[model samples]
Target chain A: HNGSVFHPGTIVFPAALATAQAIGASGRDLLVAAVAGYEVGIRVGEFLGRSHYKIFHTTGTAGTLAAAAAVGHLLKLNPSQMLHAFGSAGTQSAGLWEFLRDAADSKQLHTAHAASTGLMSAYLAKSGFTGAEHILEGKQGLAAGMSSDSDPSKLIDRLGTRWTIAETSFKYHASCRHTHPAADALLQVMLKQDLKPSDIAKVETLVHQGAIDVLGPVTDPTTVHQSKFSMGTVLAIVAHYQFAGLQEFDQHFHDQDICSFRDRVTMVLDPEVDSAYPQSWIGKVKVYLNNGEVLEGRVDEPKGDPGNTLSRTEITDKAMRLAAFSGGASPSEMSAAIER
Target chain B: HNGSVFHPGTIVFPAALATAQAIGASGRDLLVAAVAGYEVGIRVGEFLGRSHYKIFHTTGTAGTLAAAAAVGHLLKLNPSQMLHAFGSAGTQSAGLWEFLRDAADSKQLHTAHAASTGLMSAYLAKSGFTGAEHILEGKQGLAAGMSSDSDPSKLIDRLGTRWTIAETSFKYHASCRHTHPAADALLQVMLKQDLKPSDIAKVETLVHQGAIDVLGPVTDPTTVHQSKFSMGTVLAIVAHYQFAGLQEFDQHFHDQDICSFRDRVTMVLDPEVDSAYPQSWIGKVKVYLNNGEVLEGRVDEPKGDPGNTLSRTEITDKAMRLAAFSGGASPSEMSAAIER
Candidate 1:
């Protein structure tokens, strides 16, 4: 929501799976609950507006309400009960961006806490527990406490007609979503010129303000995970390898050659890009070559966006690679789980 | 912290007991952990200031850090790890006043989640997990997201010289702390005048803004828990029974006579009380008798305050009565547990 990006699945899936399994729910029931969670979570995130995203992590704050919606749906709660769940969930909504400055594991804990707390809210509501009915728009509410630019209409806009779950994007590059546009743009310029990393004198990414706000903190990333948030590192990997994947980040993020390339990359705020942001991430980059020639590359939609989505095969391959990298499952095991 | 009143034991004791039992820590260690939790939580709560208290629940927001401090101490974490735990805990600090509007059970969930989440953060930090080192005062931290009137000095005020744990008050009335001053004052007026419930025509309470902010929502409370937040209900019980204890609230809170008395009670804002409030809750009430006689009562310190603490015997009796009321423990079981 707004300019901040986070995976709704991190919170919703846990709540859906837990509630579904506990109640012996059908697969169709689980899927419906998941969709409801995404819709409500996304709407809430959007409602909180830009000011809220500047400081609070939407995934953690809105994720609680999303998780509750999914569980409440699965439980077949009455309207009043569902509202109580929202009240309970909203009261406990919390997450901040401070941890990003330290590359903290707080991101995982935030989603985990949101999922569990939201699930608990649904269960409590089922037991006739009361909660604030006007929690979202009340005098003392989520927006009142957390946002300066909240819009109530964003919550119910296109309500049943629009499905926000379909709008969620896949991560094409193994980096922060803020860096994806620039990474893709850099790769485009490098591919068009048939040039190597050494041929580039400087590369300037014409970016949005949100990108700067989120990615500007990491001047010198020391860890692999932290390096993913550094726009310079992501653009450097893209310029050299064409694909800023997990392997590239893990193996060469801090390579002397990559670091040298990273130093050459800079982010410049562009009015056009800033205006289009959150709604549309417009990628525009200027590549200055050693031969005194400047080339421009632009992409209206970066890869993995709704308009430029990944294929089913690409999704499968990405999932398999991630599973293999973590050693979470073997190839056959992963395939069997996916099939199930 | 600020003008908000919350039970520190609700968040601290659970975390300390859980960690102590999990690690098989000594009784002294557990006690030390609880104290550490109280000191840090109280400091953080005070640091966030009055603006934070208006919308957020102090126990829930500051409780996470307090719980983490206690658990981290028990885990023998290094300074760096302890700092990381604080960061993780701060990122998850959340609770809102919205739920109180509906007499919600969210209060219990808030403390429960704080205890568990804080415990988890400490464990994660112990395992080398990094977190924001400046979560309390960072640009995108707790104060930035939650407070408009935060004072950093409150966090370090007295530091090692004074123990905030010593300042926490016990509840003398089975009602919201916001109503205690008025309840005590009303009881005093009736006692001084040798008046029965039938003799009083009206009771006016001079209260602080914080009390109004917290207690003003319940115009006509319907539940036992909700009635505790109604100044009128508490004062009415006090006028009738000379006490607003658990039994009084449970049995007579909704009685016809009590309801009639409740209608005559009113709360008016007082600048003197407001200025001294949070630091010192002073009670002042005016009782207008049926015969046109007026009696005034005042108390600098209410019962169960640090200046007017309950005796050991009273504390024991209160505990036994509470346990018996909930059927959580028998008298023998309560005595044995207390002895152990």
Candidate 2:
């Protein structure tokens, strides 16, 4: 089970549209290809060791290859050509961790590139060109070159039996993944204590090293991208609104009161939490109220983590919500199509 | 001076088209924007140190930022907004050493991504959305995060006094950049001796570390992508046809004799030659003839290197030659537009 904030439909739909159009494939074929792609993409992401973050972005880079494999399968490419397609996909693989630097657009574009390039690689392979046979295991192969260490057998290691798409997390907010646990914990504490922004003297967050490395010290983030990655901003928004979602990404997402409240929130890095991350996306939130009240909440596992899975209905609701913002699709329509 | 291969017209044309369409910018505005983008992209690549087999592909990552800056300048985005656009581009920045793993399609796609993403960031900023401001200089900036080290000052170091496009290398062959020097040397030797492929017993190539890392070993390459990155295949194509270009990348480009001869050629890594690269893109070739004779040729600098630059007429000639193969616009038309 993984804590990725992507729903099956959202991941599969965009990929299906691009794959179908590129190959002149039918809509039904496209849907089947997308479901297959989502399954492989999630599995590859999971098989990659949990600490693989130091090497590559599992979603965009590995996801692209999985998507390519699905397109290859749908196009009915022979085994040899399918391997070539995977090789081509491997060569095209890209998505750097630097995106977390400022909540850059690369985060979104990584998906766009993976979807488009995976489709393109499949089409190119279908045009009768060959690729490497041992792309994944060669001396200078994908795993050898990109990953410091990887198990080649993990690729086909129980592929059809276990599906990765079933294990992914569906995001309820559009913030950095690392910030979700803290945001979830902070929201719970505020809700339980009925805390008001003015009544809070200080809010202290004890989080993993990775969290602070990713979303720490929000000193005047002037842009939506920066605010989205800021713990201070997320906590402030939560304290003020009692929730965090896409609305928090608006241009005027931050107000003076929110900014003032954000200044009072300090994040302390805890090594114990740092060691447990990816395996346990835990967080601890301590709130100091102005009325001399102290409330604390510790989340060993966030709601979206595989440990606490969202129902299909809940996933459909979030997808529809996002689709409404993305335009031209409704939740029920998407759910029906996905169900098929 | 940069050693990267880029056609000014090719780079400028696509960049101009996307930026103009996205911002509703027009004629003269588009032209100025293209020129500005070319200048910035080239300069940024140059400032990132020199291109090598191991370093990140500078063109795509730095080029995206430069293109964004150019678009921002044309659209007249304020300093803060322009910086955010740069930050947005940086976060989205990607391109890896693994692309050279087998000269995959992702190689070309990198350029397309840079062009498209740069335009996308500028368009987003134009529509009044905000992005990170200190994407380059923040505690976790692009330079500090992506590469071993980056000089943010290089971005604005020589804002206007320097011109980068003026120094770019226009490729003479369709293969990987590292293989160019050796291919140039092989062609020189073949042309001088006027020897047929059958007359050659064995071909020995001495090249730099970068070349070896990219295209060493005559071992089999099952696909076109792999062959393009193979020194053996490149030398085979060059020895057989006395040239390698875009036409040779087509489906019917391979010949049995070339493939056979490619197997006969042995490539060795020369530390002496490797040390001279970037500063001097030189390669040495020694051919053992069938009749107990040895023929040798050394190319200190390829034709497209900045020192031995291709003139406007030469560039046009090259474009026209490529256009003929693709049934696209004539070189004259491309040259005319570029001159304008």
Candidate 3:
């Protein structure tokens, strides 16, 4: 499977669900459409990675490709029509990292925008509206404008044979996926040693230089975004709270002991780990205890990776809990209906 | 007024008409909205002009800016809402120049896409969905990714007082605006001489280098686009037919005597004219007649330029002709109703 920096699910679900509803498709059809959506999106994202990520959101920029491919497939578009879809979708592609500066909900908006634009592109192409034939590799095109260094072969090489969705990672953590490895590593050390927050002298998390650039400042987080991105705050929350729950991002946790202990945490750049990233998001953590004892944990790949997927029971339980929290019926009744 | 490579009317009219119809706005409201739309769109287009034009159609790229501004004005959007409208619209901006190669209907499609996207942006912003605050001028933004040479200060400078629509040109010729000056010069020469096509020996058109670059190859055109962009074909049609009407672009005229005579025409580059262009679309035509007479004609500005605005009677008469040609009733009755 091709590697992408952004989660394909955030892009695929919005497009698939919207298209499914529009076409009166079944759940199975939605799944198949989602698969195509994920594959196309992931490949385009992987192709436009690095330089594109420096300025734009992979979810919005490359996600349009996924959406168009998936919806176009569902509509049984001819190759010419498909090309037009890509043309229109490529021209429309846009999303920016600037939103992250304001912690704006524009992140969600980006996904929605991609979904709708993809739908529009497909519909127009189907109606015989022409788009650029060489939107990706053309001299003056998306990659040329959006990427400083780009390899378009990544977009088509082994396209049909390689199924990116099958290799996608699932997430159990509430914070950003980037923080999951460190959180997993830290939790394991504390769990194995049976040590409380008071037993720790200081905590250090080591990962790739790329990770440090993304998750930085190893300091207290004043906002939810800061908590999600800052390794120090994420690690502090995991170690001190003994769990990395959604509530950990709340502002009420600001005055907690974890926020102060977050200052003691340091993030280091390990070249070994640095060489592994964007392909492998690995993390290693070391803890010094007040009792003059040390514990260490390392994770090459965090839980929920394709190699270490969550069990069916765990997934069902998580689903039920989420449904109940979102004002659904009792978990047992909901499960029964779903099963039926 | 800021200059835009794409006609702002295509973008402005679609968004304004749709939004006005929905909101029950009067003609005055639509006009005001259109003015705002034209100004904002023109500024953004000028900023992203060269590099963006290489790949993207200016209509689809900058048209969104115009649509959003115009519709957002009619919707009474505040500054922050307007910002979000721009944010979402810019990300959704896309249209490729590849359509030009095919002479496809996608050129018109780009305008429609901008109209809908602009409306959607305004609607989403009004609903409190957040978008990037500095979408245009941000470090990682539309200008950065879309243009190799971009200056975003133009987006806000003299935004209100400098009216782009006021300076807008209203094209009367059937062909592309680039061909207008040459057509005007040719028609003037023909009218002065009262000459038949057989009377002409050879023809030479001297225009700015910029115009030559856009309208190339002094040769016969097989397609309407070629006729529109070719200096020779346009000159032949204007001189022989004595009019550059819409019907002259039809394929029936491809085998006409003018097509063969088009070979007698040549285009020249004038450095003085080149330096004056985009601001001035001037062309000089010199014709050598078989009757041993050389007639010279020049036009400093085409018929539709703001400096040589068409009179109200001329505008109304042209509108009535178009309306009647498109299945409207008698001009007198239609004009009376329109005036009311």
Candidate 4:
């Protein structure tokens, strides 16, 4: 997790589902494959370290190998074949952050490429197509080309003993993870003071450098997808609507009031937060009211984090809301599917 | 063309052909698109500089953009759309040298992925899928993330004035490009001396650091593909037979005599050659005979290089041989196609 923020589910789930369907695998097999993908991808992200996330997109790069691990597990590949799959997947590891500057559609493409390419790699390995043996830490491997701060130890730290999938957090706000900490902290202040959107004249978020590195580029977001990366936009949406859900982002991200509130927000780099970062994302914000009143808010664990994880009921509700927003399924069908 | 050795045709031609066939484009259209691809890919590889090629495979990383340029040109994309296509292609640029260490099949996969992905980027851009505006030189762009010695000026230098497509080389030997210079030098020595394999006791190849960096890992190549990267093996094949072509490598690469000759070959880094590399590949070799006599051989330009390019007749012969080797076409069919 380090300085890198990625949704392993975006890469792993697609690969697992695709492989499971292709192979007629059971639901239990899919779950096991998903776990394998999560374990490999999360550790690979950690292994790549902070420097890699600075330039390379971890979800695309490490995600490729993660996808291979999942698909390979589903295929019941031998250890040798699995290593070969990683090698091929690592060779194809790619995705840069430049697209964020233009609000490009590359983010979605990255996940698709990772999942498909990784799936292909596992299939190739099963057919005896050899690949590099040491693609992760080798002299000319992914870390050698993509990361300056790679730690080989992170790749196999606890192995079977540690289930890193549990460490994954759900997104409470339908926005960038970098904004969630600040979003939660702002919500805490609003609830405590019973403050309305018009009550707070200015909001200052004290965040780690990682937030700025990722969220700093979007000065004026033109699209809903891009606005999610804008710290100010997320905070403004949450302040006005109480939640930065898909509907809020879709309909009101560019609304006049939200845009005005967006301009009233700023991010300041804090040393304490930066130092504790990756390991822990601590949110601290300062609020200035029109009545010459100032209030500070802090949230050590943002909602949906492991420490403040969502309950089954909350997850179910969130799933239903997502289905409704996307018009993916009717309520009865969604409930039936969820129950199954 | 600098320190990076790539077969631009491997990426560009495939993409151009695929796009042209899909769209029913003219042969002239395919030719122009290929030229565009070659120009963009070569410049990108040169701009990335030697540092990028050290770890990243130039053909895979730069080739993706090249493929995109070719396909984009074939699609008749406007400047903005072409730029967007490049942005998407660059974000997905990837391939590592670690695969070479294991004689992996990733090299073929790299070209396939680049060609397909690049083609897809062009189609996406045509559909108004926006990409980064300045993907190559942007803060989190391809160069920023993949290369430390990237030169921004080289990307646009000479623009329409210089036709880089003319600079591309044909591979005279079936082995890696790094081995070609020395292979030619060895051929020169053997021909001039009119000596057989038994006449040579030991041979030392004077090469650039790039050659050593690429060929140093294949100490005892077990596969025919791996043997191509082995400096010792390539030299051995060339010494025993006048040429190291596909047939020779396939059938005789693992022969005991060839393996013994492989052990007798050694590579020594030469300062003059190292400094002049990328721009010029000078071959210098020392051949020690069993009769206690030594001879020096030098070749300023390797066979198949722009300066010493193959003639049309030789090219046709080579194509026919290739078709025969792969059983892809009959001699008459090849000639008919070549005539067209």
| lDDT (C-alpha) at residue B10 in model 3 | 83
Q: State the lDDT at A292 in candidate 3.
A: 84
**What TM-score does chain B get in every candidate?**
0.97, 0.82, 0.87, 0.97
Q: A1-340, model 2: which lDDT tens digit per residue?
A: 3432223343345766766686698767876777677765655554444444453456666666667867786788787677667666655555555545545555666666677667666777888644445555565444543454456566676677866655666565676667777777888887777766788898888887656655654466767777877888878887777666676667345788888877887888877777776557787888888889888888887767666777878777777767877775776777787788
Worst 10 residues of 2 chain A by lDDT: A1-10
Q: Please give the RMSD to the true structure for each candidate, in Å.
A: 2.1, 5.4, 4.5, 1.4
Determine which window of 10 residues in candidate 3 chain B has minimal summed lDDT.
B210-219
TM-score of chain A of each: 0.96, 0.82, 0.90, 0.98
Residue-level lDDT of model 1, residues B122-179, one tens digit each, is 9989998878999999988999999998888888888999888888888888888888
Q: Is candidate 2 or 3 superior in lDDT?
A: 3
Return whichever of 3 and 4 wins on lDDT.
4
Residue range A1-340, candidate 3, lDDT tens digits: 2167776777677777777788898888788878888877887888886778777778888888888888887787899999888877876776776665555566777787788788788888898876767777665567766777677787887878877777877676667677778788888898987878778888778876546544553244556755776666777778777666666556434656767777777888878776777778786888888888778888888877887788888677677766776677797887996688
TM-scores for candidates 1 onward, in order = 0.95, 0.76, 0.83, 0.98
- Residue clash pairs of candidate 2: A106-B92, A130-B223
> Between candidates 1 and 4, which one is better according to TM-score?
4
Worst 10 residues of 4 chain A by lDDT: A1-10
lDDT of 4 by residue, A233-277 (tens): 999999998899999999999999999999999999999988888
For model 4, what TM-score is found for chain B?
Answer: 0.97
Tens-digit per-residue lDDT, B1-340, candidate 4: 4434667999999899989999999999999999999989999998998888888889999998999999999999999999999988998999898988878888898889889889999999999987888889999999999889899888788899988888767888899988989989988999998989989999999999888878998889988999999988899999888899999999988999999999999999999998898888899999999999998899988998888999999899899999999899999999999998
Best-performing candidate as measured by lDDT: 4
